[model samples]
Target: MKTVVAVYTGQGLADPLKKVFQELLPDVRLVNIIDDSLIGDVVKAGRIPPGVARRLVQYYRNGEELGADVILNTCSSVGEVADDAGKLIGIPIVKIDQAMAARAAASYERIAVLATLPSTLEPTMRLIEKEAAAAGRAVTLVNGLAAGAFEALNGGRPEEHDRLILETAERVAGEADAIVLAQGSMARMESKLAAATGKPVLSSPRLGVEQVREVLERLSREGEAAR
Candidate 1:
């Protein structure tokens, strides 16, 4: 089985993505590269400054020797740097938000982007809109940052996270055709968001696993065809 590597900035995403992928593509190896150091302070401070991207790029470089089949940056704060790393790595490097962005564009013209970190919202929205435009569609990106709720969850209070996410989704309900949760970590609250907004909820981790499955399937077919 081919292995795919995912790098999450300690947002506690590996398990979620791993679980989704295990069900979706059982044969592939899903490896996690966790770095709590880069995203912790920035998310704690409620800002995603420019330096964080460089740090992420450096981290990916150090792990380049692993020869991961696919490299996914699960931290939205470092997507630009993730793109840069993708350019240098010569592999199918995926931004965690990219798959969700593609799905959002395909599903709705007015997409509400929900994120746990304010720093992640803008980038995630931009990525979604960019994907939409590439598909010849115009998208309206709405910000639904639920940092307080996510912080509460990270602090061992899942109820608070659910409350805040539901509350925020209610506020943004009328404005979107579909709700797109920006982080793989944020997908944990999807059920609550869907119930509150009464709309379809798109999650990165779910789409990321879909992306992995498609790519791996293609690779597998190519190998079989060649033989």
Candidate 2:
């Protein structure tokens, strides 16, 4: 069985992504390494400082140590450094947004990246720009921050959190070609966002799993060729 190492910088993603991997590619082995503080520290710092980025390199090295076929970084902020890790690890390092970003870039001329956190906004936009360039397309990014939504979730008001994002998504729907949710925690908004906006809503969970499957298949093909 091929092993996929999921490095999550936040909590609650493991269960959802596990279900995703199972539904998408059942035979592939999945391992999760969660560091909730990784997101918290980055959020507090307003960006990924050098120390935080260094820790992510260690995380990638740890995945390499585990003999992972591919490494999936589940947070967008730290996902900015995934390419740097890919250079060191020699394995496919997939940011959760990569597949989604590619799809959005290919299909949309104007992409609205909706986020509850400021720290998540810039990294996701940068990712989309890189993805658009790779696809030979151009995109205009609309920054939609659901103000107070993150605070509501942290304050133990998930319903309020959902409501805020739903409202924000509706208001911002007409300004872009499609809506892309930036965080795994916001995956729940996919259906709601699509329903309300009647626009394409791209989230990372399923697409990210599909990307892992594709990478594993390529690796398997390479191994067979080598043998």
State the C-alpha lDDT per candidate.
0.78, 0.88
Q: Residues 144-191, candidate 2, lDDT per residue (tens digit)?
A: 899999889989999999999998888888898899999877886798
Give each model a TM-score.
0.88, 0.97
Instruction: List residue ranges in candidate 1 displaced over 4 A.
Output: 44-51, 221-227
Residue lDDT tens for model 1, 53-80: 6777666765566766777778887787
TM-score of decoy 2 = 0.97
Clashes of each: 0, 0
* Colliding pairs, model 2: none
